[model samples]
Target: MRFNIRITVSLKEGMLDPEARAIQGALKNLGFETTALSTSRLFHISLEALDREQAETLGLQMCERLLANPIIHRYSVEVLQ
Candidate 1:
């Protein structure tokens, strides 16, 4: 079966996001009011697996092994049909 997956990776709370900060600063300079900003990496991947369970398992493993840093980054995995 083929599956579509969305993996989102972002810094955990209390972790500084330099890119977000810079973007917020730029927005403010452009006369946009923003109280807070956060950024994340979103990956849309397509792959084939035997079943949904296996697909989910592989997705988790991928996140743990390479998609995210457990120490400072939080990630979410979604399997899209």
Candidate 2:
């Protein structure tokens, strides 16, 4: 059997504001400078023990149900076949 597993990563946009600020402060402390900085969440997913086509469908369903909020932000999936 073949498998095409996709991993989707997402984050709350405004939720990262505070983290971004913290990163900026850390940078300042380290004497590293940047005009812009941002933060995001991460997710690692996999679909195994399935064939290529089924794995694709599973990845899509996972994205629609859990990986993406559908209200804010966008998501991308990467499949390893």
Candidate 3:
């Protein structure tokens, strides 16, 4: 079976996001007000799997092995159709 997955990676809480901060600053300069800002990365993956559970497991393994750093990054995996 073919599975589609969406993975979102982001910095852990208390981690500084320079890019988000910079963008928020820019927004402020443009007369926009923001209370907080954060950033994340989205990965869309297509692969073959035996079942939805297997697909989700693969997605998590991908995050653990390569996609995200356990110490500084957190990630979520969602299996789509």
Candidate 4:
């Protein structure tokens, strides 16, 4: 079977997000009020798997092994048809 997987990766709390901060600053300078901001990455992958459980397992392994830094980042995986 084929699966559409989405992995969302983000920095853990207490980690500084300079790019997000910069964007927020720019927005505020442009007259948009903002309190806090953070940045994340989304990866959309299409791959073959035997079943939904296998697809979800593969997605998590992908995140743990390569997509996310376990120490500094937290990630979530979704399997979509």
- Top candidate, metric lDDT: 3
Tens-digit lDDT string for candidate 4 (1-81): 899999999999999888898999999999998888888999999999999899999999999899999999999989988
Clashes found in each candidate (C-alpha, N, C closer than 3 A): 0, 0, 0, 0
Candidate 2 residue 57 Cα shift, in angstroms, is 3.0
Against the true structure, what is every candidate's RMSD? 0.9, 3.3, 0.8, 0.9
Off by over 4 Å in 2: 2-6, 11-16
User: For candidate 2, what is the lDDT?
Assistant: 0.66
lDDT over C-alpha atoms for residue 38 of model 3: 96
Tens-digit per-residue lDDT, 35-62, candidate 3:
9999999999999999999999999999
Q: Which stretches of candidate 4 lie over 4 Å from their true place?
A: none
Q: After superposition, how far is residue 27 of candidate 1 from its true place, in Å?
A: 0.4
The prediction achieving the highest TM-score against the true structure is: 3
For candidate 1, give the lDDT: 0.90
Candidate 1 residues 1-81, lDDT tens each?
999888899999999888899999999999999998999999898999888777788888898999899999998888897
TM-score-better candidate, 1 vs 3: 3
TM-score of each: 0.93, 0.60, 0.95, 0.93
Please report how far candidate 3 places residue 75 from its true position, in Å: 0.6
Better of 1 and 4 by lDDT: 4
Ranking by lDDT: 3, 4, 1, 2
